[model samples]
Target chain A: MRETGRPLLAWVGLAARLVTGIVWIVAGGLKITQPDASINAVRAYQLLPSSVAEVVGIALPATELVVGLALVLGVFTRGAAVMSAVLFAAFIVGISSVWARGIEIDCGCFGGGGTKAGAASAYPWEIARDTALLAASLLVASLRRTRLSLDSLLFATRPAERAATEGAMT
Target chain B: MSSNSKASARAQKAAEMRAAQNKREARRRILTIAGVLGVMVLIVGGSIGVSLLNKEDVKAAGAGSSEYGVTIGESDAPHSVVIYEDFLCPYCGQLERATRKDLARLAADGKVFVEYRPFDLLSSIADYPIRATNAFAVVLEKSGPDVAKKFHDLLYENQPSEQDPGSMTDDDLVKLAVEAGATEGDVRADIEGLAQQAWVDKATQEAADSGVKSTPTILLDGKVFQDGRTIQDMADNLMAELE
Candidate 1:
């Protein structure tokens, strides 16, 4: 699976890449306008210390934006995919913890400063969304190549390496 | 095929395996490069985010300025009650609900001038308080003192439970004002233009500077009222100060 080169997989990778990329950009863009609200949103989970939450709240949007742009442009496919996976996974953990604590909260993934949000887990759909995005992220990370990716152009494999890659896949 | 030739073919396969390993190595290099670059971009963007988040450009909202607060009663009222409040604060809500009419009566009688200063300590608790404060600031700026106080009371009356996330929006605020007989006229500007933000920020900063540590921080005739004062108490104090 690691070495296999399938044109079909490339298409799947592109789909995942674009979808995850857009989600990150949109989520980050919405929160950037209200940094304080963004901070509140981070603190909503009760997972981090207030000071730490403040930093994450202020910085996460920017990181998400950068990662999104990278993924959409297909500039750094593997790295962006990994970042997407980490972020989604972190969100999953946060939501799950809040649910476990019987605490109410909004994920604040979009906007509105995430304060006093009623139970986040009450909406199982959010958990489901993050899970799906996580899967997409993993899929993007696994594939060595994707359609319209800069990876192929700048990091083209030599014929010898290509043959070896195929061999390993087999 | 001869045995020697067949053996050579096996060796060639082994070489192909090695070449594949090399390709994997090269792929890793590419991934590493991209990952490094991605992290670098995030660092740059994050620094900008941090700086912007920490930055607060505050200015004096103005003395007796309607932009930062609303004044009730004649300017020359012998004593004044300056209240620093957050509309979404449950405590402030309690205080407001408790003494609203009495304070108005005091104002009507011109026994004391009442000023409500909107501050934002709980901006991190939820966006609504800040949003509401910003909206109130707008009302104070454009809608005249009467409408501003009305809008202010309306906000406390309608404040969602502290646990509700993203409850109030600018549209909701504008609608409330219109319902209370006020026009939108540049209300959007006051809210969106952040025209009142600097003033609110200044007021909040000054409140902090003046050792105001909590909501309902009331100053009666330039003295901090250690105990929360009710309307009756306020009237009594006015009389005492007059004497």
Candidate 2:
């Protein structure tokens, strides 16, 4: 019944959805092309065993791409947003751990990752970026009925339907 | 009045029916979302499972032998220094230039055992790394580690700029092998022919399996040596460790 700022909130959700969606697509696309580089990037973190890292390296890009597609299309928007949030949170933890462990590596978020000459300085910025994306994904997850979304088209009751239902109720 | 009451009852029935339809639609939407998420999870998990299953355990394949890499110095040395290097990696070159003599001296003095794992990590970008690694393997196989060590230094010395990496040819590597004291006659044929390419491939995979993802990954006594970032820092760290 409180509908004063509903449109504004929907617009915010739309923006959040698009931002995280496009980022995931781009990041996943870049990594998928160079899987070996991706694997090396995961290995650079030095957190997981080689076997686990290899599997993650091979599978992560596809997961990112699917999540991105779902969010961008606004189909299963909540589910995709939740997945995005989880991934960004994991990335944040990984970056923080590497920083704490004194390992120097590129975050490898958008592709090109390995041991670099002066990569430690970039960890803070990478964490900040992931944290921001995580926040945006959380917003999208909470506001599942964003404007101009497939969820709205497929799931939300249309104005005509709402009117008919309300008329019957009254 | 009777007609009015009948119409109101009909209207109430229609509303209840509409509400029921709306509920069903919401349930269907939730089910659809759940189904899509389930499919996504299956895809991610399935691919990861397949890849892990396919990934061979290279460590188990080699049986803890020097087939994985080349070791320099006495086994009885007080310390062990392991280095992973790619011939084409510029930073590896820099690190080698800085620490080559100190590491060798430490090894020769029986203070440290140095192991060099040359792998073709940059093969994704260029085949030159693989070729160079193959050449190193050939030299090591034919002439042994002393000449191979010289060949290693020479490769770094002739390392092309990353911009023009392909400029260095197999002939160039063969020439370096000869200069480094490998037997001139058959060594040239072997280096150019990539006679030890299989060994190079095996060693590279073994290095990767061993978690040497980046070049110049130095492990001191089986632990990552991360005391510094710069070549100077690495050089200083190695020297300090000797004392």
Candidate 3:
């Protein structure tokens, strides 16, 4: 039963990792390509002050790239997963604030794509996507040991083997 | 024989453990490399796609030497209007589309001489290699007035969304110039030389000196046109002054 479950768990982990990583990488790369546009989008939120927005605009994309790469590679997977969750949580909050204020503008997530005009909106959809991604990231972070990962191999080292090696060295 | 079998079993177990560890390590390395390469490919591919999608069309419009000082309307109809605009400004674009026909008619009649000075407002906000004014300066210097006017109209027509900020590239600017009637070589050389930039900077400083604070600032015979929101309002004011 454990053996059967192990492959299933690893497959699930792989799916989560790929989804989160691709989303982050695409989002980050888009922003980097149009840095000024990204900065303008951040400024439109008016959540952060000018100076802070400037710094955040410059650093956020690069940070996303690094975190996304680590998660996909399954190296420092837990740490990267946690960071991605936190970042998405912050983005959700920001989007919710703007939506609450009745500001009609695109979130600028998937580049220049804008929301439709009317009572119905894209804000809810954006928040929902981010929330779902956050959950998946948190799950991966908590379930640190997965098949085909460095962490699994490292933790799999046997205590008996370690003690035998120590005795031999002495 | 029993003791030998026990030793063989222990050795086999150790070997199996070592093989498992090696397999895991190999898989991990392969996955890592694949992930990194995938990311690099996405970034590079996405960037290229964006550049292609955002490519600007440059064409030089012909007004020839008369382009430099060519006035739009009546040369002596009693009013002279100069417009300072930034191509990236949404408001400027709006005004251009709304009032272009009227402005052209007024300029063609030689009654109102229209001068266009393209300036940049986002230069302070963003680090763009090609300033808004740079394109205008290039068109003005190389293509002449008629082409400059055409180029200016085309830019406003293709202005980026207000939510996004950035200027057109030099190549795109040159493409726009050629569409406006200036030779591609001349536009390229002028933009490359950066001489047009000097003219843009000087015009911008002069506009500031003349107390122009915002884009699409209209000056009538060296006087600011206050309250000229619409094209009709401007024409009415101009006619009223003449009457």
Docking class of predicted structure 1: incorrect
lDDT by residue for model 1 (A21-65), tens = 999989887777667567666765666755677678778888888
Runs of candidate 2 with Cα error greater than 4 angstroms are A1-4, A158-170, B1-16, B19-27, B38-84, B87-144, B147-243
Clashing pairs in 2: none
Best by DockQ: 1
Q: Whole-model lDDT, candidate 2? A: 0.78
Candidate 2 C-alpha lDDT tens digits along A1-170: 22225888988888888889999889887777666678778877777765676768888987898788788888888888999999999999999998997767778899878765457888888999899999999998888478667665455456575565456557
DockQ of candidate 3 (2 decimals): 0.05
Give the best candidate by TM-score: 2
lDDT of 1: 0.72
Worst 10 residues of 3 chain B by lDDT: B57-66
Chain A of model 3 scored by TM-score: 0.81
Better of 1 and 3 by DockQ: 1
lDDT, candidate 3, B96-124, per-residue tens? 77667776776666556666666655464
lDDT tens string, model 2, B1-243? 699999999999999998998888788778867887787788666545554554432222221145746777787788877788899887788888888888888878888888888888877667888889999988888888788888998999999855577899888888899999987886888877778889988888778777566777777777766455355676688779975
Local error of candidate 1 at residue B41 (angstroms): 2.8
| Candidate 1 vs. true structure, TM-score | 0.49
State how far residue A125 of model 1 sits from its true place (Å): 1.7
